[model samples]
Target: MNTLLKIREFDAHGGPSNVKMGGDGHAQTSTTVGRFVIKSIEKHVSYGKYAAWSGIAWGTDIRIDGGVVMVKFNGSWKKLTDVNAQWGKYKNDQKGVADAVLKYQRTLYPDSPIPTKWLFNDFGHVSVKYFKDINKDRKMNGKEYIMGDFIHTTPTDEAATASRKIFQLAESHGCIHVKPNDIDTMIGNGYLKKGNTIEVHPYTKKAIDASHKRDTAKLPFEVHFYPGIYKIAIYKSI
Candidate 1:
């Protein structure tokens, strides 16, 4: 299964319709992937405005948005979920990061020695860092090591609770949280591995302008790579 993540987006062609077809349903023909623009943003009385990603219910407080997690499985693209493959938030929140990950980071991470008191959501079992916002604008500030953000899914048992929000808190410090099974599916099918080029689209400008920057300086700030051999390929320039 040598499936590669190929993202070739296309613009929608919808005007007066070049021609009409005979059928009970409507259809259009295009030779490329479609990139539809959807503006989803709103302001809160206290917290602020954030781009709400699809599938996540309201009041969840998930900061990740404007991107799709997909994989090529069995000759097709499938939506990849966000969630740590193994550990959930409850187990990973307060000092539950794996030893293998720690050792690997200690040897390769620019900021080696882990602080004794570092207690936050571990970067999950298999995390792939993505280009984070460097300019305080919370938008796509280009692919740079601005934040130690990753496309990770902390394996958790609170999918229903966290997803539906029983007063659910913010998912991660700087990582995108997805369904745990999605992580497994990607890894199992070899859709997510080294050199794979997955795309995370940009957030809306209004969403960006209204977004607030977080202070993750006190914690680890190294971008890209965890213990897993898999790596997310980012080739686009900011």
Candidate 2:
């Protein structure tokens, strides 16, 4: 791994973005893909590979997963969402793949160098033994728990309105989606790169936000959320 960009995903709902997993909209998280490399920054990203489950427009929408994308730096943990930095949402939208991606394509095509199974930048392969890039093939095998889970951008029109650009952000199937410019900036400034570790700290009901005071009583530790730049004040231990 280049440097560990430990992408931690917390469980909370508020402004900006809120993520829920599973078919019932639960935060179904577990030990899954955690580290990998920038497999490819593709333009032609298709979701048809996992369509039977994703049901996210099948082959009609590709740019729905567009934007600049990132590449990394540092060697510490990075929360998928940050108050003062890039915001994110982790969603487990994958059950698994049933067929080859090309099988669903007819009149559709990817952006430039089309990625295998339409997988955009993989962020990096999960460090787990089973999730390893088996067969030494950079492509994810269909048998894997999470395939085609990428950390990239989304279509400008879907997430936001013309007046309030940069929508609060949302979750993309099986992966995490961050603010567009933040992603671009990460890749441009080398804060994010291929071959780095992407540690997805499973989502939980526990969250930290100043906007909600009623829920703090449920937390084991205490976290004070400060507005403005959005800061966190930890009391005792978290």
Quick one: best lDDT, which candidate?
Answer: 2
- Show the lowest summed lDDT stretch of 10 residues, model 2: 90-99
Please report the TM-score between candidate 1 and the true structure. 0.27
- Model 2: how far residue 195 lies from native, Å: 2.7
Local accuracy of candidate 2 as per-residue lDDT tens digits, 1-238: 1111122222211112243455634453322333343444433323333322232221232321222211111333222122112122212211111112222322123233331232222221111111345443445565534334455444431223313454554334444444545545445543344432233322342443323222112222322222212222233312
Model 1, 45-64: lDDT tens digits are 11111111212222222111
Against the true structure, candidate 2 reaches a TM-score of 0.35
Q: TM-score of every model?
A: 0.27, 0.35
Error of 2 at 176 (Å): 0.9
